[model samples]
Target: MMGNVDIFEMMANRYDTPERIQISKATADAIRKYLVDTHDKNAIDFGCGTGLVGMNLLNDFNSMLFLDPSQKMIEQIKQKIDDFNIRNADTLCFDFEKESRTNLQADYIFMAQVLLHINDVELVLSRLYDILNVGGHLLIVDFNKNDEIVSDKVHNGFDQNNLTELMTKIGYREIQSKTFYFGSKLFMNHDASLFILDSRR
Candidate 1:
């Protein structure tokens, strides 16, 4: 496992930040719309941070498994869910690098801002493909590194061209992307994007 201790610590500290709060709602809404339109009920929030995505999902989804490598983050999420009185929720502290060790399968998976922290993006994508049911959708939201405003070195951003190529190479089809502002600017000066990828047989 790639020592995600710092990542979890970061979440524990900044789980209530304004930027995180704002981005979570927009990202969750976009993801929720895609999942609902496809009639997907069973879902998982991969890299779920302090359950921000889970918080947005509570009203629309009845059951969801929240998975993260950070125990501290999961604890924070548990607190949030408890405060909201949300039920039928579960949390797992495991690494995508070790996903083969777990049995995680769902109709839809929401992963926000987690891709940038991962070094083996392609490998994780394959793992996600393996775990999702047929006709499943994977929603990814991250800052595109190519965007001029993104100043974080840890962020591994992807432009539309590279993202499409990666998804296609992984045997994913029906890939679509949309750009949105997720940070300091209201007009999307930050190069963030939301991707919807459909699993293929």
Candidate 2:
């Protein structure tokens, strides 16, 4: 199994900074546009660090499952759930890349600023595909391809077209993508642009 520990564990206590709150709000608003007939659906916020984006999107779904590998991050989400009496939300600490969860299922799955941290993109994408119910949507929000950045622990970014091709190979259909937000000091204080990719399982 992949080690779930990371810097997020240490940062969980102070992860929800004002800057992240603002970005999460914007990302949630953008994600809301593509969400349709979701009032009766269950959604999973994959790699939901402290539930920033998921918390903004609770009312749109029947229930929200905040999943992250970082236990501290999951604890943060649990505290928020308790603090707000958010009965429709829950948290789980598990790594999708570690194993396939045949019993787990959701009508919608979203990853906001989460994919870059994954070591194996295609593998995790396939794992998510298994977790989604047929006709359900997998929404990914992350930085677009950026060759300027270099990292061994994370991706520089992703090429949307290439991502679409990958999803198609994994049995996802009705794929679509759009550039949603841009910032000068995003992604480690470096200028970066973000995009959202929607694919159906």
Scored by lDDT, the top model is 2
Instruction: Give me the runs in candidate 2 sitting further than 4 Å from their true place.
Output: 1-4
Cα error, residue 2 of model 2, in Å, equals 9.5
- What root-mean-square deviation over C-alphas does model 2 reach? 1.5
Task: Give the per-residue Cα lDDT of candidate 1 at 171.
Answer: 75
User: What tens-digit string does per-residue lDDT give for candidate 2 at 42-152?
Assistant: 999999999999999999999999999999999999999989999999888998878877888999999999888888889999999998999999999999988888777
Worst 10 residues of 1 by lDDT: 192-201
Q: For residues 35-123, could you state the per-residue lDDT of candidate 1 as single tens digits?
A: 54543367788888787877678556657888888888888878877886777788888888765643777777778877766777889
Candidate 2 lDDT (Cα, 0 to 1): 0.91
Model 2 residue 62 lDDT?
Answer: 99
Query: Candidate 1, residue 190: CA error in Å?
Result: 6.9
Cα lDDT computed for each candidate against the true fold = 0.71, 0.91
Which one wins on TM-score? 2
